[model samples]
Target chain A: MTFSVEVNGVEHTTEPRPGQCLRTYLRERGCFGVKKGCDSGDCGACTVHVDGVPVHSCLYPAVRAGGHAVTTVEGLATAGELHPVQQRFLDAQGFQCGFCTAGFVMTTAALDEAQLADLPQALKGNLCRCTGYRAISDAVRGVTTVETACPGRAVGASVAAPAGPQVVTGTARYTLDVDVPGVLHMKLLRSPHAHARVVAIDTADALALPGVQAVFTHEDAPRRRFSSGRHENPADDPADTRVLDDVVRHVGQRVAAVVADTEAAAEEGCRRVRVTYEVRPAVTDPEEALRPGAPLVQATGNVVGEVHGEVGDVEAGFAAAAAVYERTFHTPRVQHASLETHGAVGWLEADDSLVVRTSTRSRSSPAARCATCSTCPPSRCGWWRAASGAGSAASRRCSSRTWSRSPCCNCAGRCAWSSPAPSSSSVPPRGTRSPCA
Target chain B: MDLHTVEQWVDARTVDAWRPGDAWLAGGTALFSAPGVHLRRLRDLGGTGWEPLVEDPDGRLEIAATCTVARLAAHPVALFGQCCRAFLASFTIWNMATVGGNLCAALPAGPMIALTTALDGGCLLLAPDGAARTLPVTAFVVGDGRTALREGELLRSVTVGPLPARTAFRQASLSTLGRSAALLIGTRDADGAMTLTITAATPRPHRLRFAVPPTAGELREAVEDEVEHWFDDLHGHPAWRRHLTFRFAEQIREELS
Candidate 1:
């Protein structure tokens, strides 16, 4: 259906699909600041002023926004003048990774002094993945000026992040903001059963879908095993994973992938790519997993490896100590819940070499792993960064593939030049790193 | 993340002539968050033309199905404001989440359920056949995430009577951002009758009344005997909920008395 809305004071008319949401529609229309941290309204990354009221655009239907006035981070600046909130954030050094900055700015800009008292409660919805709330709150509360020690360097000074002004003005770009042309959308068909063996995969139905480009399964991928958790050194973790495996280890594990022209088409293709599974007994408890007769998570064994360390002789240390205490504590598994999910865009170079840009910590490991899985030489693989956090292993387990000719919005291009942090010398490296752009 | 199965959308202004696989779209905060492969078409209620909120001459409030939590909080009804605080939703969520959506979601943690039920609220339901009926808030929710809503029936509005001059509220949760583990609300009627309602910690709201303010022992006995089942989930254990409910109930009684 044709949907028309006024965005950033410009009237935009577009034919949005029935299932399309305002979040995806706005981003597609070059409003890169509206991020999709969580498609659900839990995260306010997609917050925008709809008729002057902040609403999570992810939950708002694109068609429902017809004839409404919308204001995004990009609209905060008028006639090349910065909005007060944007300027305040810049002065306060309000962000670190800057993933959630635009949402916070949008919300804070609409607030008056009356609402500032409940600042914490008002901001409870928008989560910043990197920095603490002190700087952001200070920025919104108009605590702009801070004492600085050094004139040139501002060493140990509470200055704004290099990316602050761009972030607040809604011009900064993250991985998802990249406008890649003719990008193929990829979706995975995850296993529902925790422990199961893929008996058969019938892809004929999925392949029949109109826009389906490729349906990949274990048969299509290399049999080489590598750890999904990539460390600086490849030998640090167990090499126990393949690109696709016949044996599903746990629920939500990808068994097959569908690449199609559109996200909806890819998802429909994923749903259609049905596989027959032989369900096996699953072990959920860690103690049960260590039992002698427990089901093996890996073919080698459930126990990957063990490390034992001692600073001093245990018996001697205990005898010398007045008291000895030992307690077994259980720590739950944690995902590196970065505001921006892990994603990668890859396409073959003109010379047939593959180049990949991804949201990951280790730069070279993805290329090495991809080369290992695709039977390509390491020299033929190139790597780039898409944006990552300090410590998050969640993206390590899953690889987000952005295909060639996709809409690539290289955020680095916009910020790399005007970045306020004095490290302009690193700009040349980014230029060489982002080959696909 | 994409809604793959939704092929059709009907901008419904009315609740008539509903078809299969059709669902009402209110604020859509919960509906969009959930896996809705089963939903083929959405009947948009945004154009229903219902006033967000209204206060009749009788001092009773009529909250429209599309009324957002933020709007309801802005209303002068202080009791509702207290309940709105219990929602624990962010300003973004509050601006988007609706009162009817929370109640109709039938989640045990829904604060609207506790508020409306405790205040003797009634839901105005409109069936597909054009029949309309009013059901108390307590009878509307059958179980966790399950409501007594009939097929193709829509919640038009919820009417709540004037709040008691003397009212007390107490809520307990595992964490600041966590769902309510137990909620106790006490009210004193104009006639000096007392009503105690317990929610969140239970599968549904539990209510008890007395001609006069009951003693701590009487309140405790009534809660232990009447509250046959305590809602069990990750929010809190049933035992912990029962204990908290007992303690909070006493605090409410004392505060209201």
Candidate 2:
């Protein structure tokens, strides 16, 4: 099982388990430049050069690289100078969240003049959820000198990201990249039926597992309801969510949580817990749900509230206007689909106070919400906003302020959190020269 | 969770000792994209060192199962190149995905099926006992996400004969990077015979042959009567697929005639 390979001209030896992929193997060896988005190869977030050819490390077996040479975004730079692709990315400010920047850099660096002619098709694998394709195309085109300089700059003079060099070089650290000591992994068992009531949950089998630290159900957690969405004021939103509930309104709703020594152990523990459910009729369409009698999503009613806006005299304006168009548009409810999914880490400090790190825009809200759910003193809790490449909604209970060396859980409801970057605080030292100010 | 259940990996040079639960690994593009909890071992075939492409004296080209899409598209064949363009896969996917993998996936929206079947291609299959057999590309794919591949069998290569003297292709999609809703390709051989192949709009490629170009009305009736299933999915509706397939088929017949 011993795998010895040359990475960026240095030889390293690793013993990967049978199913360990190359993305995880590289990250364990401090090669954090290779990011893991979708374990599936569709995202291309884990692209690396295997024997001078770009391949998805998430799909490649760690043992497959035993005798081959590998290159990551961290290896793009020579002794002191940045690669032309990296330099152009920095100059054009082509990235926003920068989670997909390393993958883009790896693909763009290998492009030649002939391939540049088909640039759109060439860089299609790397998905930058934040920035549009214009800036990315301009950066790649600038390197080849195939097009003239774009005209017209905005009012303010152009400025590069403060952490642009570090991002391109794969030195910037996101929430998941931060290292914590003696942390336990948590996993949830979700409901398969959209509308159902949990009749009984037997957790005795799950607690018998070897590495499982704790198994929690609705009976053990707090009973207070809280709002999962973000609002200017926490009280402005309706309190329709609890840490765990007996009634499941939608599929994929959390039923119970398992905290264990490793992710594998947690996953295994989740599968062992058995639950009895009473399935109920469900409605999938909005109009159908609003009919005279439909399964209610909430205890109160199917409809929350209606809003009617008027800019002027509607009937008079329509009559006087030359032309008026009316149409009904339906927009599907879709996830923000950030490159990084929601994640958080929490632990008790030496002072016996709780500290939680997460990626969120509502700084004070998480601290306050964590304290309220933990039933601990607000002053004793420490909450730090994660330097997200892009923000995502991490769910309730996950950021709870409970003070324990054991696992504390958080849930990602429908919250979308995006954090703007170029801040120096998020950059980890990777021994690269700073970018031009 | 990750693929934590895989416990064994077998590196095989040939199809001699293949077993059940053994999956062949070429580019690992489609294999890793979806969940494969049933797979216990991956038999690495890229190590076999099969030559990517070869041209026989008869002007037929044999494409190895391990040949990447990018390599196949870069070759000098015009019809093959046009089909490769229909893939619409990124350079990264093009470099890692194999032509054999695409055909074996048997997706209703697969562009490789459209290309190879249009040019009268055949698949070379090798079973675990070292027995080899050949089947036309149209018969190789049985249904969606289903192939005629037997357990422990490996697809060796695909053979594409010389291109037709006159060929034309038409494709339509919902979006710029979306999967093809309907693809209609027509070719006229040197003997003045014509073949029309339709893909993406059906569960399998539907091909129509004629000694000479068929009449416009005949083409429409043949498509409407022969194709029982128009292939319904998220990319396009069955009604839309049928409409577009008929419209494109007539346009190709007119252009070739």
Candidate 3:
């Protein structure tokens, strides 16, 4: 049976792809605004209005959309004018990184004025990472003016963010939105057993599968070690990790990466690749990990880094003191929960220069900045500021100094002046390197 | 998850065709919630044209299998709001997930099972051969994710009681969001008797009755004796669910009493 859907007043009647989700269907059809943060409806990034009712489109079946009226973030505005909700968002500055803005807009569009009072309950399904929800709340409540929107900060001055219009109207492109034709989809075969050494990997079946491009194991990775830490002076950063590792230090570590023509092929290739493991005892505790006979996490000893600077005989100064006290302060390990997840797109230019686009906030280059180990010269490989936060960026060969904005509602064509981010960059890509999009 | 094997979707009301890999699609929530490559075809009930809800003159209610949770909560039945709130799901889930799907998913955390079991509800099931049978909600579910649904049988609707002059109190674990680890509902019948419906904490809904309000010790004893299969999963350990069930049972008992 033909699957028919009226999306944003346009009817699309086509043979439905088997088991396709409404989110993927809509996204594939140029509804770039309908984001998919968590495909399981955890994040409201894929929220859309199905027949005037808000729904997590990620959970809706594409075939089921037949005869349903679907409205996405892109459809909110009419006659090239912004919707009132979108306008209010621009006025209130209701976003941080704007990754979750589309979902918030869709959900807020369905709510009545009274629902704005209890946003925690009304917008319970949608989640935001950076804004702390204050600006979003202000926008939903239609609190115009910067001073009223946020009293303490920007009291008298009013300023819009880099991509507010595009963000609110769902026109801004994220790392996942970038499309390069011929880009092969890669799926990681994660180690199921924690602290196990991958003894053997049989990729003959995977390679035999149709559409299978390449199957990469730790044995095949470029052994040039690199650290994923943030250190301006590269010396302090420990070059511990690699593209892939035989010894899985933890569960979900990348054991192999299967490249294929399609996502399904890559996933099936990953499943077909058999792996054998040697279980090892794990040291889960910080104290136990530092013990004398503990299993070493790295080839080197466990004490990876030590900070000690002798300032004019510190021990003698302590001895001369009236009394000496010792204590060890403890703090929980923190993670930078950026609104945008770690993602990047890499491709080789005609000149064989690698250009990568990622959500690297204010950083220069991914290959030059994030993946720095002197393997690739900084001039040949570099990144420019793209999306929000100091997330990630990489490059091996490219001109690295253009600070172009991502295409959005206000600056869609204008932003394409200097090697701009792809407007409809879906597919037709070249080269390789995408870490978690 | 993609049901790649699914080749056709037949309306549930049209033909009595039952294949080995056929699955009933009502709301398609839990069924489509995750991947199921085994599902070959979907038997959809959207074309069944069954009334979502039917009200009896004697205050009885017959809720159709396709009744969405949001519709039921919006219903005038006040106790329904209390039971529907047990879902802890957002409006998105409530608008899509169906009552029959909840019961047939047979998940221990299904609030519909808990609600029906408490109200002494009965299930109306129909076989592909046109044979019909009605079973108590307590007997409908046998274990976690396992239902008494025979192959090719369809759960048509559920009939819930004449809820008048009945006092009910519900307690569930976690926040007002997501799945419940433990949910307990205590109701005082018009006859001055009480029943505690324990759910989410156990494999199946448990209905414990007492002519009068049971003492804390008596309630604890009945709970400990009756519920042998306390559910254990990421939601909660069996012991934790048991502890919370017992604790909520006492609190609900005191309040209802």
Candidate 4:
């Protein structure tokens, strides 16, 4: 539907796609500052001012935004001058990673003097993963005062992040914010049963979907195994999972991948990809899993690895002690819940060399991961790495540096490279003014 | 994902226009919160132009269906503010979710239902052919996600209490900043009668009334007799909810007494 709406004091009329939300509309129009932490309203990362009241744009329909004045994080800085809240955020160094910064800035900017008294309750809508709420609270309350005093030595003095201004003003772009043309969205079809043997996969219907480009099943996937861990030595952890596995060991394990022109089409394509599985009994409890008659989760006897190191002399130490105490402890599983979920964008270059943009502890780890998939089979075998710029000279033999990630023949002559952004060299441009036409 | 099935948006002005696949859009909080596959059209209620809050000569307050939680929270009425906080929702939700919508959603733990029911509130239902009907808040909400709202009927406004120098008590339980496990509200009417409305623990709001502040044992027995359908979800168990309900019932009775 074509409609005129005032965004950042400028009016524009455009046709919004079917069932589009205000967040998608603004972001598509180059308001990159409108972050999408959780597409649902729970995260409040897409909070923006609609008629000067804060609302979660992710859930607000684009159609409802018509004839109303909308303000985003990008609009907070006028005439190259940051608003007071943005300035306060910069002074407080209120953010790390900066994905959720725009939402916080927008929500904070909408707060009036009266609301400032209850900063904690007023700002409950927004969430930050890297930095706690104190720094954000300080930004609104005008604390931290931009301490520039290099008292005695640099070690004790608080140093401002070089990108602090950009972060505070929502001018910095994260990896997901990077625009890529002709990028196919992917959706995974996971195993519904915890323990099952994949009998066969029928991807004929999914591949026939109009927008679906490819449907990858275990039949066509590489049989190589690779460790998920980032330990320097590959032997430190067992290489259990394959890119696609025939045996479904756990629920929610990737069974197939569907790539399509759009997210909806990709999801639909995933739904259409049928699979036949032979259900097997599974034990979820630790003690039950250790029982002699329990079903094996792994072919190598459920136990992946064991530590047998002795500390001094166990019996002698306990014998000498007046009292003995022992307990087996367990901790609940927790998620990082990072504002920015881990993702990678990979595409083949002009000469079929991979260029991937992803984040990992080690730069070459992605290449190393890709290398293991192509070189090492399910059985115990040595693997190699393919460094970027190796191009056509990509080595088939193992290299000393084990972390390089170069795609091989199984990649269908495609590869990806990774990089970071928003440094001095890169800038999140103030997109074309209004595009009022 | 978006609500792919929605094909039309209607700026609805009255209850007579209601259709099979139509959903009333007030604040759009609950409607837009999830993808409703069955929904084919949104009937916009924003154009209704109803006054949010109004006080008559008798001092009875009328709250429109469109009055958002955040707006209601700012009202001087102590019960309104307390009920608003019971949602435990963030600022954005408070800024958008409506009182009428909350009562209509009919969730067992809906604080609006608890507040209105405890204060002797009545819902004005605008029927087709320009007729208006009134139902007590307790009768309006039947059970979980179910309401007495009939076909082509619109919830116009809710009128609550002259209150008459009444003192109110509210107690809500939750592990963290999440859904309420049990919420119980008590009010001392002008006649010196104690009215306790129990929610969150049960599938529907249970009201217990005593001519005089009931004895601790009487309040416990009344709660046990009235509240039967307790939720056994992550929020709480039947026995646990019953225990909290009895304990809170006595506390509210004592506080009001």
Best by lDDT: 1
Give me the displacement of residue B70 in model 1, in angstroms.
Answer: 1.6
Best by DockQ: 1
Report per-candidate DockQ: 0.64, 0.48, 0.40, 0.45
lDDT against the true structure, per candidate, is 0.75, 0.74, 0.72, 0.71
lDDT of 3 by residue, B1-257 (tens): 24445667777777766888888888766766675756778887877889999989987789999998889989876778777866755777677888998999898988899888888889999999999999999999889999999999999999988773565655566555557888777778788889999899899989999999989999889888998888988878888888888778888888888
Better of 2 and 4 by DockQ: 2
- lDDT of candidate 2 at residue A257, scale 0 to 100: 77
Candidate maximizing TM-score:
1
Error of 4 at A191 (Å): 2.8
lDDT per residue as tens, model 4, B151-255: 767788899988735656555565555677788888887789878988888888878788899888877777768776887777777788888888888788778
Query: What tens digits encode model 2's per-residue C-alpha lDDT throughout B17-93?
Result: 76666788888777767657676677877788899998899888898988989898888767667777677567677
- Residue A100, candidate 3: how far off, in angstroms? 1.3
lDDT tens digits, residues A255-374, model 2?
Answer: 887777767677779889999999989887889999988988887988766789999799999999999999999998765666765666665545655555655555567666655554
The B-chain TM-score of model 2 reads 0.95
Worst 10 residues of 4 chain A by lDDT: A385-394
**Regions more than 4 Å wrong, model 2:** A143-155, A204-211, A313-329, A375-377, A392-437, B14-20
lDDT of 3 by residue, A8-109 (tens): 999998755656678888877888788866566667888899999888887776778898999999999999989898888888888766778888888888
Q: How accurate is candidate 1 locally (lDDT)?
A: 0.75
Residue-wise C-alpha lDDT for candidate 1, range A309-396, written one tens digit per residue? 8886898998899999989998987654667754555555556555555555555666667766665577976665654422345434
Between 2 and 3, whose DockQ is larger?
Answer: 2
Clashing pairs in 2: A391-A417, A391-A418, A394-A412, A395-A411, A395-A412, A397-A409, A398-A409, A398-A410
